[model samples]
Target: MNESMEAGMEQYLTAGAAGAVAGLGVAVPLGAVGVLVLQQAMRDRRAGAAAGAAVAVVDAGYAALATAVGPLVAAALAGVEAWVRLVAALVLAVIAALGLLASRRPAPAGTTGTAGTETAAPARVFVRFAALTFVNPTTALYFAALTTAQGDTLRGGAAGAVFTFGVFAASLLWQQTLVVAGGFAGPRLPDRARVWTFRAGYGLVAGYAVTVALPLPAL
Candidate 1:
């Protein structure tokens, strides 16, 4: 291979690697979304996988946006940070309340006691999580900072595509791990344990709502 082409390939590989690392950094912290995903997994693997994919898509989209026009979005958000947080908090609070209520109830008649049975559709779950994850402006800022640090490695063309794909793939991989763990653990847990676990997950989500509203440090 020619020297210039070899150098380009190396750069693309490096960008992909960097993007994957950044994705893991973003996803591994087990925040509110992560907690919810795990809880969903315990109820139904398909639903959980759908939610996880949504998160990955949003994360990759935010990363791409951060690389392309982060400064502008950041600047715009700064003017309405409080309002944004308020909306996000309200949404999260509602989700937590609904989740908690759902946990308390039994599965609908004639259906299995799983999210797959109760959730209506995996596509719906995906849309819901995609919207939820997209509301967090912090994610975009995070990618923005990383992209800035990366300098030209994350610029347009082949590098950008590889980086974005890497982010999506890595995030999905981590989410799948959570789903698998939750799925396995769910079957083994006692009935009471399962209910309590769901409660705990929703409770954590509630806590996240409060933190987001307060604009405090969060996972």
Candidate 2:
């Protein structure tokens, strides 16, 4: 097959096997991710399992999608042909620094489930989380690194396209799971308990920052 020849020749262009595996690692946050999860748990305690599930879904969805298509995204960037190293480094440094700060921020009032006496504003809450998460700079770094590493694998035309679709599917599956769980837990938690739950959540964020920056010497 003509495609087979292209596949064979492609190995010469990039890291291939090792790079594909590495793509997954670039987004594996040892620190901030946990903090966010815990924070979500605390915030959604009153929200019931559904709220928690939603948080998880969004988190996992983004991560998995970022991992799978990272290569394609990076390839697009490679074309920019600018001072990429400098740019990536600067961006990463700022993100790491911000993570440290975000960890220390005061937890917001209200459990994700805790609703105003008026008909609960589910849409607004969902939108709020989306905005907060999408704005995080570290997310950009994670995706950038992943895509850059996967860029080679994604160049194989049809095979590459299939891989990206699989990645997207996996991401969506994980995120949706989280959303369902959060929704279930939304209405079960109490007042004071929810507040400290989030403090713990922020603590995890702080932890993530430390882990990413220092990367505890591999055991």
Candidate 3:
């Protein structure tokens, strides 16, 4: 029994390492969502950290689903991809509009409010990030492909759980790094520069949303 348990533990560790690699592979790409995460970090490290956590949570959830029932999840996602993209695009547009409006507002008094006007509630940040991440069907598809390619080695039971945990951990680490870097750089920028950066970020996000909504050829 002890030997069997030890072997299982070893398998879980191996699966976990694989999951970590997969997580980093997906998270390292500086997409619109990633840029927004950096923007959040620039405003407040805590908010950025929360956004990072939310991203990890969504990634882990997708990883877990893929590990458990990859083919089924993939099929479901394929069926709903169009609708999901539409919803995601609309949500991003709304967010972008809000950001643009906020950026145009005059700065309050003498203080340089790097944190901006958005509430820094971790829960709100987490939910926002999670919703943003979840709407992208590609994330789910990516997890499904990764898990399916790995075969049975990383599928189901304790091994799957460990793998999902690893994904969450690695993603969280990457996000934290972004948050820290953004926080470090945000305070140094002049008010005008910061405002312009915010506008640029909003425009980029809006562009990404429109791109997602369109049926463009995948790069």
Local distance difference test, candidate 2? 0.44
State the lDDT of candidate 3 residue by residue for 1-219, as single tens digits: 999999988898898898899899889998877888887888778888899999999999999989999977667677567677777788888888988888776656554355344435878989989988887766887999999988888788888999999999999899889999989988888767766777888898899889878874344
Candidate 1's residue-wise lDDT over 1-219, tens digit each? 699999999998988998899899999999988987887787778888998999999999988877776666767776677777878888989988998887777767776435322644789889988987887756777987788667776866789888988899999999999999888887777767777877888898898888888963244
True-structure lDDT of candidate 3:
0.83
Tens digit per residue, CA lDDT, model 2, 1-219? 889887765643333333333333422333444334333533443332333334434444444455556555566666442344334334444544554454445544653333222123445545544543444445555645655555555444544544444443443344444445544554465645544554455555444434444523333
Candidate 3 off by > 4 Å: 1-6, 77-80, 107-112, 115-119, 216-219
Worst 10 residues of 3 by lDDT: 110-119
Residue 12 in model 2: lDDT: 35
Q: Following a full C-alpha superposition, what root-mean-square deviation does model 2 have from the true structure?
A: 9.1
Candidate 2, residue 132: how far the Cα is off, in Å: 6.6
Ranking, TM-score, top scorer first: 1, 3, 2
Candidate 3: residue pairs that collide: none
lDDT of each structure? 0.82, 0.44, 0.83
